[model samples]
Structure formats: structure tokens, C-alpha cells
Target: MILLFGLFFILLIIGTSIANSMFISSIIYMIYYGLPLEMIPQRMAAGVDSFTLLAVIFFVLAGALMNRGGITTRIFTLAEKCVGHYTGGLAHANVLASIIFAGMSGSAIADTGGLGAIELKAMKDGGYDEDFSLAITGASSLIGPVIPPSVPLVLFGVTASQSVGDLFNAGIIPGILLGIIMMVVNYFICRKRNYGVSPKASLKEVLKCFIWAFWAIFLVVIIRGGIAFGVFTPTEAAVIAVAYAIILGLIYKAVKIKELPSVIKETLGTSVSVLYILSAATLFSWILTYEQIPQTIAGYLIGLTDNALLLLLIIMLILLFVGLFMDITPAIVILTPILLPAVSAVGIDLIWFGVIMILCLLVGLITPPVGMVLFVLSGISDVPIAKISRAIAPYLVASIGVILLIIFYVYLMTLNPSLPKLY
Candidate 1:
């Protein structure tokens, strides 16, 4: 196991693709142990053969659907309506808009692209700096995976055999907390720069936008509320969300028949990337299991530390650093299996730990080296990565503050404790 892990890192350092890195590392272990190659296909298939994992494709498509269905614009309108009166009104609206968005789609990249494209442009048009627009939009996108129906959380739940509904419920409070902190930080900064909404919309106009878009808003409630009351599983909720978005899109005349092909193509491409990594990672984990590597490491770690909190924190730090180098979805798929048993050994709550892990890694995806969100903002704003990363400083501080709250404050971290727990 140590030899395999060492080789994986070496492959990574040399710029190998993570999928191929894991694949080669597993092959080294199999060869070392004189195992048959047949286990590879079998284990890989087992990993990919998950019903819960199918949620990844569904939610990814559902998020893209809502965006095309004119729901993105409606969400922006609603956020703008409610927060456009603040000192840093547009910035505040960006934060709030992301919170609303995180509910509809549990993907960080999707939210970043969907909401950031719209809000960053609006911010620039409203007298905000391009870099500043880039920064806030990127940071706001982090909330998506921490909120309900988060794709990473769903993946974690499925991979770890934790409760998906409980995981969804557990995410709500922390998600809102993440939103609030960003809004507060944005408010103070925007006030300092004196960048509020330019020519704020009339209440009538904002209300009109909201009224015209009311059904789009309802999808969040219907999906979340239905899931909470046990009316549908998360997978079923995904189907409902797609149907809802399509029906509403048609009713609003926002989605035309012509858009279907492009939408399907995009969704299929995205889903394939995710599913490919999943299948490959599963094969890798099967190798680990066959070798009893995870169990052996779990035992070794337990022997070293009994403090669940310390162990969990250390794991988070590792995730934070790893996230700096990789994208979130692949990281979650690859690492969750390896880490779950070890954390469980220390008695850390799986669901809570999962949220913490996702948050840390998601932030990493926005950090330097390979910060995916940073790159997204760079592409959108045409700001250099170095410059956009500078803009990330304050929000990064605020994110760390949120991370600390989740780590130390038990009641607040868990949020009402009565919210069905996920671990």
C-alpha cells in the first residue's frame, strides 16, 4: 500500500492525469501481489454500479436545465430584488443569488459558470472591478456543494453508505452560514469601495421579474420540501426537478425546441467525465480492498490517534492541500473511499466529516495552482490568474472563518442538531 501510494504521488508530480495515475498505481500493486487482472474489471464495475451515484448525472443535468430554463435569470432577479438595497447591493445580491442557486444545483463549477457569468458581468457593468467581480463570483460558487443536493455530498453519501437525505438535511444550515459570511464580507468591502447597485431597479420592475419567475423559484421548495418529508428519494427529486424546469421553461417560453440538442450534448459530456472518473476510481478502490489496504491503513491510523477531532482536522488539511491540485468531483470520488474507514475508526461523524471535507476541497479548487473556479473567473473576466487570486484574499479569509465555525462550534456546526444528521 505504501509503495502504491508513493507511486501515485510520483505519477501526480510528473503531470500524469489522475485517472491514469490511479490506474497505473493499482497495476503496480496488483503486479506486486501477483493478483489476477480479472479483479480489475469486476471491482471497477461494482464501483460504477451504484443507484445513488446516478444522482450525479441527474443533478448535473437538472442544474444545467434550470439554467437554460430561464431559472438562472429568475434567481438573479429574486436575489437582486431582496438584496439590491444593501450598501454593496450588487455584491450582496451575488452572494444571495449563489445561496439560492446552491439549493437548485449542488455543483460548484456549474454554479460558478451559471451564476458567475451573469453576476460578474452585471458587477462589471455596475462599476465593480473585473477582478473584484471575478473574486466574489468564484467565492460564492463554493456554497453550492455545501448546500442541499450537493453533488459532492451526494457522492460522499453514496460512496460512504451514509444517508443521502440526512446528508442533504445536514448541509442546509452550514450552507446558509457560508452564504451569510460572504454577504457580510461583501457588504463591508463594497461599502469601502462605495460600489452599490447602479441605477437600482424600481420595486415594481424587480417584483415584476419575480412574479414572472415565481415558478422557477418553486422548484427549490418542491424538491427540497419533498425530499425532507420523504415524498421522493434524491434520485426521484432529480427527475422531478428536470420535469419542473422543462415545464416551466415551456410555459415561460424561455426554452425553445431548438435548444434541446445543445443542452443534451453539454449534459452528456459533463456526465461522462464524472462517470468515467467514478468508474476508474472504483476500480482503483477495489484494488485497495482486495489488498485490504484501506483496512490496514485504518488500523494503523487508529493505533496512532484516538482523538477523532484531531484526526479529522488533519484529514481536512490534507484535503485542502490536495484540492489545490485537483478538481473537486474527482477528488471526492478518489479520496472518500480511502478516508471514510479511517475517520470512522476515530469515531468522527461520517456525514459531518463529509461536509467538512467537501468544503475544504471545494475551497482548494478555487485556490492557486489549479483552482478550477479561479480559472473559470479568469476565462470569464479575462483577468490573469495572479490578479484574480489576489482578489480572492479577503473571501478566502472569510471562508476560513466559516471553516473554523464548522470545526469548533458544535451546536452551530451541526445546526439545530435536530436536523437529521448525515454521518
Candidate 2:
């Protein structure tokens, strides 16, 4: 175990990719144990050999298609029309837009990369400070993974063998709460900073904008409604999302038929990279399992405290720390196996725990060192990482607050089972 992790962290410090780091570390661990080398490919193959993972690919493609189809612009326009008149109106709109976009994209990087430019440009034009604009942009993107149709949730489902539908259901309230809390924080900050607001949109204009963006927004309705009503599984929702995106693109003339090949190629590249990480992490995870690492860790955790609430708090802190160094996908894949036993041992609901886990990890996206959202925004706006880090403090705290609220909610539900379960 020491040999494996030491080499992995050393490789990470030197800038080795996560996938390569895990693969190399696992191979060395196997050699040290005199395990047959052939098991490597076998374990990697088994890792991604899930029907559920198809949702990951299709969802990636759908998000790419929607971005290419100009759906993000419509979504932004609609949000602006709805909330562009209030103090810090554009900031509120930024959060609202991300919440809506989250339904379709389900990936934080996708939301940041897709909707971010539009939000920043609008805020800049509206006279918002550069640091504030960039801060909110990065922070709002975190909502993407917490909402339904989320890529991370899908990965969590496959990793923990939990129902993706229940996970989606579980996330609805928390995701919306995260957005609301961020917006509330934005309101106070913008008021103190005196950020300006635009003239309110007339009801006629708001209606027109909504009509224009309706199809794009309805994608979420289809995905969430379908899953909630059992009309289709999450995997099927991905396919429908792709088909709907293509159709919506054609209707808007935003995505030409010829442009699809490029979109597909982009999707393929992204999907393969994610799958590669999963495969390698699976091999690494398999080694841990073979050595009974999960059981040992679970035992130690239970020994420390069998109290469900306390164990969850410890798990949340560990996830937050891990998120500082690891990308969310590989982190979910590697840690879910090791941590689920500990979580289950404490009688915490796995479905609720999955949402809690994802929420905690999402904060890492805006945090320093490995905050991918921060890095994306910094590259786009040329803001210093230091400034971005400082600017994001309020929203980061808001996220943690929402997470704590959920934890307390779960604990309360445990005390009284009559409350509707998060699942």
C-alpha cells in the first residue's frame, strides 16, 4: 500500500495525468505482489463494462450538442429577461442561468466552458467588476453536477451500484438550494459592492424570451420528468437528450447538419478521456479490493465512531480534502468503493449519502490548486488565480452551508422516519 500511494502522489506532484498515475501505480503494486500482469487489462475492462456508463457518453454528447446548438445563449437570454432588473440582477441571472443549464449539461466544466463566456461578457458590459463577474461565473457552474442528469451522479450510481433515478430525485432539492443560497449571497455582496441592475423586462418581453428558450429549457423537463415518472431510465434520457438537442438545433438553425460530425468528435474525445480514467482507476481500485483495503478502512472508521452523523461529517471532510487534489470523476470512482462500506456501516442511506458526497466534492471545483472551474475561468478572463480564489470565498461558503443543511436534514430524518426520505 505504501509503495502504491507513494508512487502515485510522486507522479501527481510531477504533473502526471490522473489516469496514467493510477495505471502506473496499480501496475507497480501488482508486480510487487507477484500478481499476474494479465489481470490489469481484465480489471480495466471490467471497470467500464456497465450499461449505466452509456449514460455518461450520451450525456456528454448531448451537452456538447446543446452547447454547439446555441442553447446556452437562449438560456442566458431567458434568465436575464426574468431577473435582470433586480439589484445585482445580472449576478442573480448568472446563478439562475446555471441552474437551468445544469438540467441539460450535468457537468460543471461543461457549464463553465459553455455558459461562462456569455455571463462574463454580459456582466462586464453591465459594469460589474471583473473579479466579481468571474467569481460568480465559476461558482454558478458548480450547480451543474448537483442537478439531475448530472454526469457525476451517473458515475456515482455506477460506482456505488445505487439507483441513478433515486440519485437524481435526491439531488433536485439540494441542487436548487445551492443555487438559491448562492443567489442570496450574491444579493448581499452586490448590494454592499453596489453592483448595478438593468431596467426590468416588460412581461411581454419576458414571455417572448421564454417562448424562444422554451425548447432548450424543456430538455430538463424531459430528463427529470421522464426519470421521475418512470417513463425512461437515465440512460434512455441521455439518448433522448441528444436527439432533442439535434432537433432543437435544427429548429433554431444554430447547428447545421454538417457541424454534427465535429460535435460528435469532440464528444468522443471527452468521453474517451473520462472512460480512460475510469478504466485505470478501476484497475487501481481492484488492487485495493484484492488487498481488503476497503474492509480495513471501514472497520477503522466504525471503531472511531459508529454514530451515523459523526461518521458522515468525517467522510465529508475527507472528500473535501481529496477533492483539493483529485478530479471529481476519478475521485468518485476510487473513493466510492472504499467509502461506501464505511457509510453503510453507520446506517446512513446510500442514496442520500451519494448526494452528500457529490455536493462536498463539488466545492472542490472552485477551490484552489485543483479547482478546475477556477482554472477554466482564469484562463478565459486572464484573472489571477489568487483573485479568483479570493472572489469565490462567499459562494464557497454558501455551498458548504447548503451541504451542512442537507446533512442536518438527513440526521433529522433519521430521528423521525415519518419525514419523506431524500431518496
Candidate 3:
């Protein structure tokens, strides 16, 4: 296992793609152990042969379609009108727009790439500092995977054998709470910096913006409502989302039929990238299981601390450290199998644990060194990575606060029988 991880890191440092790194390391481990090479392709095939993964394919397509369909602009316009009068109004709207956009697009990259451009432009035009605008945009994009229809949550669910609907449900409160806390933190920061507010929209204007955005907003409600009411599975929800996005595009005349080929091509590229990582990680995880590495680690951790709260805190810290170095997708694939048993031993609910794991990992999207969202923002804004990292520090602290709150809430729910389960 040590050799396997060492080889993986060496490959990563040399600029190999994550999927390729994992595949190379797995092959090395198999040869070293004298295992048959044939097992590799078999496990890789088994990795992606999932009914639930169909959701990932369609969701990726739906996000791509919506990006090209002009849904992002409507959502942003509505967010700005709804909250543009608040302290740090654009910052607040950045976060608000993320929450709304998150419902439509379950991907943080989608949120950062699609909406980051518009939000940063709005902030710059409004006389905001470039670093500050970059920070807020990157930070708020984390909300994309925390809300329902989240790609990470779906992956986590399928990996852990938890219900995807339950994971989505569990995320609602934490996602909203995190957004609100960030908004409050932005308020103070903006007030201290004297960031000016936008002109308040009149009641009629607010309604007008809302009316224009109603179709986009309705997509969120329909997806979550359908899942919660048992009207559709998460997979079904993704298909519906694609259909709805197409309908929206046609109705608004924003998405022409001619553009779909390119949209589909883009989705295929993104989906293939994700599926490849998942496939490689699946084989890597099988190697770990075959070595009993997960059991060994779980036993050691369980023996290290009997206090569930302390154990959870320790696990979260480890995940945060891992997130600093890894992308969330492969991290979810590799870590879920290793950590789920340890968490189960500590008496944490799998659904709650999944949410917490995702929240911690999403924070990494804005973190330094390998922060995917940071890179995305830097590319879009032409800001130095260091400047964006420095700007995002306070927002990082606020996100930590939200993570702590979730940990406490999970503890409370575990203790109280009368507490309602989001599942």
C-alpha cells in the first residue's frame, strides 16, 4: 500500500492525470503482488457499470445544456435583484446566485466556470476589488455540490450504498446554513471595507425578475420535490432535468437546436473524464480492500479513540488535509470505502457522514495548492493564485465554522430520538 501511494504521488507530481496515475499505480501493485493483470480491466468495467452513475452522465449533460441555454443569466439577474441592496450586495448575490445555480447544476466547476465570469464582471463593474470579487465568487461556488442534485453527494451515496435521495435531503439544511453564514461574514467584511450597496429594486422590479427566473427556479423545486415525494429516483430526476432544460431553452428561444451537438460533445468530454477517474479509483479501492488496508486502518482508528465526537473531529481533519491535495471526485471514490467502516464503528449515520464528508471536500475546491475552483477563478479573472488564496482566507474560516456547526448538529441528531431525520 505504501509503495502504491508513493507511486501515485510521484506520478501526480510529474503531471500525470489522476486517472492515469491511479491506473499506473494499480498495475504496479498488481505486478508486485503477482496478481493477474486481467483483474484490472474487469474491475474497471465493474466500476462504471452502475445504474446510479447514469445520473452523473445526465446531470453533466443537463449542466452543459443549461450553461448554453442562458439559464445562468436569468438566475444571476434574479439573485442580484433579490439581494443587491444588502451590505456587500454583489457578494451576497454571488452566494445567493450560487445557491440557486447549485440547484440546477450539481457541479462546482460548472458553478465556478459558468457563473464566476458573470459575478466577477458584475463586482468589477460595481467598483469591487478584484481579489475580493475573486474570493467571493470562488467561495460561493462551493455551494454547488452541497445543495440537492449535487454530483458529489450522488457519487458518495452510490459508493456507500446509502440512498441518494436521503443524502440530497440531508444536505438541504447544511447547504442553506452555510450560505447564510457566508453572507453574514461577507456583510461584516463589506461593511468594514465600506463596499457600497446596489440600488434596491422596487417590489414590482423584484417580482419582474423573479417572474423571468421562475422557470430556472422551478427546476430546483421539481428535482428535489420529486425525489422527496418518491415520484422519481435521482437518476430519473437527472433525465427530467435535461428535458426541462431543453424545454426552458426552447421556450426562451435562448438555446437553438443547432447548438446541441456542441453542447452534447462538451458533456461527453466532461462525463468521460469523470467516469474514467471513477473507473480507475474503483480498481484502486479494490486493491486496498484486497490488501485489507481499509480494515487495518479502520481498526487502528477505532482503537485510537472510543469517543465518537473526537473520532469524527479527527476524521474530518484528515479529510480536510486530504482535500487540500486531491480533487473531490477521486477523493470520494478512494476514501469512502476506507473511511465508511471507521465512521460506522464510531456510530455516525452514513447519510450524515456523507454530507459532512462532502462539505469538507468542497471547501478544498477553494483551498490552495490544488484547489480546483481557485484555479478556475484565477484563470477567469487573471488574478494570481496567491492573491486569490489570500483573499479567500476569511471565507475559508467561515466555511470551517459551518463545518463545525454540522458536526455539532450531527451529534445532536444522534443523541435525540425525537429529532427528525432528513431522510
Candidate 4:
């Protein structure tokens, strides 16, 4: 047990990739235990064999197709028309655009890499502060994986063997709350900073943009409605999302059939990287389970407190700490098993817990050191990481507030039978 984690951390500190570090450490653990080396490949194969994981690939492809297909611009334009008139209106639009795009793409990286560029450019042209613009863009992208059709939620469902549909249903309110809180935070910050606001669009113009962006907006309804109504499985919804994206691209004349190969190539690269991390992390998690590490940890946590709310707070802290260093996929894959027993032991709802866990993990994307969203936005805006990190602090606080709010809501519901259920 000591060797497994010790080697893994050392490798991480020495700049090894998370996937490679887990893969190497697991192999070494197997060798040291005199376990069959053949088990490595078998475990990895088993990890990737999940049918639920297929949703990750299709969602990645759907996001890429929409990005390449120019669907994002229409969404952004509509967001601007609706919200660009208030103080810090462009900033509000930045958050709104992310909320809408979150329905289409389940990945934060995709949201950052796709809608982010358009948003940053628009804000810059609208004469918004660059730091504020970049910060909101990075922070808002976190919403992508919290909303329906979320890749992280899919990964969580598969890892914890929870229902993806239930997770999706549980996430809807919190995800919207995340955006609303960010916008509220933006309003105060912009007011204090005296940020510029755009002129209000005429009602006719707003309707025109909505009409133009109707197909783009409808993607959200299709995904959330399909899942909510049981019209399709999450995996099947992903396929429909891709097909819809392609058809919309053709209709908008924004993407050509010939352009699809490039989009697909990009999708393949992302999907392979995610699957590799999941596979390696699964094997690593399996070895930990073989050593009974998760059980030991869970027992220790349970010994500390039986109070469900307090236990959840401790779990959230641990998840936030892990998210600081690890990417979302492997973090979910590795920690879900280790932490889930403790979560279940406390009688917390798995679906709600899954949503909370993923949201906590998603915070890592905008944080320092390994924040993928930070890097994505920095590359897009040419802003320094330190600047982006500093700028994102207030919004970060807003995000944690949302998490706490949800936790308290669940806690209150636990105390009151009259309260509605999460799902």
C-alpha cells in the first residue's frame, strides 16, 4: 500500500502524466506482489469495456462537431441579445452562453475551447476588462460538466454504478444555480468596478437572434427532455446530439461533409485521452481495492463522524483537495470507489452525492497548477495564468457557495419530510 501511493505521488511530482503515473505504479505493485502480469491488460480491458462509457465518446464528438460546425456563434449571439444591456451585461452573457452551451457539450474543456474563444473576443470588442472577461469565461466553462449530457457525470455514474439518468436529473437545479450565482456575483463586481454595459437590443432584434439560434437552443431541450422523459438512454441521446449537430451544421452551411474528418480527428484525440486515463485509473483503483485501501479509509472516516452533513463536508474537502492536483476524469474514476463507501455509509443519496462530487471536482479546472480551463483560457486570451487565477477568485467563491447551498438544501430536506426530493 505504501509503495503504490508513494510511487504514484513521486511520479506525479517528477512531471509524469496522471495516466502514466497510475499505470506505472499499478504495474510495479503487481510485480512486487508477485501477481500475474497478465492481469494488467485484463483489468485495463475491463475498465474500458463499459457500455455506459460510450456516452463519453459520442458527447465528445458532438461537442467537436458543433464547435467546428459554427453552432456556438449563434448561441453566443442570442445570449448577448438577451442580456447585454445590464451593468456587466457582456459578463452576464459570458455566463449565459456557457449555460446554454453546457447542454450541448458535456465537457468543460470543450466549452472553454469552443464557446470560450467567441466569448472572449466578443467581450474584448465590447470593451470589457480583459482580466474580468477571461476570468468569467474560465469560471463559466465549469458549468458544462454540471448540466445535463455531462461527461463527468457519465464517468461518475459508470464508476459508482449509479444511474446516469438519475445523476443528470439531480444535476439540473444545481447546474442552473451555479450559473445564476456566478451572474449575481458578476453583477456586484461589475457594479462596483463600473463595468460598461451594452445598449439593450430591441424586442424585434432579440426575437430575430432567437429565431436564428433556435436550432442551437433546441439542442438543450432535446438532450434534457429526452433524458427526463425516458425517450432515450444517455448514450443514445449522445448519438442523437451528434446527428443533430451534423444536421444543424449542414443547415447553417457552416460545416461541410468534407470538414467532418478534421472534427472527427479532434474528437478521437480527446476521447482516446479520456479513455486512457479512465482505464489506467481503473487498474490503479482495483489494486487499491485489492489492498482494501478504500475500505480502510472509509472506516476511518466513518469512525470520525456518523453525522451525514458533517461527513459530506469532510468528503467535499477531500474531493476539493484531490481536484487541485488531478484532472477530472481520473479523479472521478479513482476517488469514486475510495470515497463512495463512506458516502453510502452515511445514507446520503448517491445521485445527489454524485452531482456534488463532480461539481467539487470541476472546481479544479479553473484552479492553479493543473487547471485545464485556466490553461485553455490563457491560451485563448494570452493572459497569464497568475492573472487568470487571481481574477477567478471571486467567481470561485461563488461556486463554492452554490455547493454549500445545495448541501444545506439536502440537509434541510433530510430534516423535513415535506421538502421535495432531489430527483
Give me the runs in candidate 4 sitting further than 4 Å from their true place. Answer: none
**lDDT digits (tens) for residues 259-349 of candidate 4:** 9998889889888998899889989999989889899999999999988899889888998898899998999999999998988887777
Tell me, by lDDT, which candidate is best. 2
Can you give the TM-score per candidate against the true fold?
A: 0.92, 0.98, 0.98, 0.98
Expressed as tens digits, the lDDT of each residue in 188-290 for candidate 2 is 9999999888899999999999999998999999998998899999999999999999999999999999999999999999999999999999999998899
Ten-residue stretch with the least lDDT total in model 3:
414-423
Cα lDDT of model 1 by residue, 237-327, tens digit: 8878777877888887878878977887999998887777777787777767767877887787677776665666677688888888877
Q: Which clashing pairs does model 1 show?
A: 351-423
| lDDT per model vs. reference | 0.81, 0.92, 0.90, 0.91
Candidate 3 residue pairs in backbone clash: none
For all candidates, the clash counts are 1, 0, 0, 0
- Tens-place lDDT per residue, model 3, 131-176, is 9999989888888898989999999998999999889988888888
Better of 1 and 3 by lDDT: 3
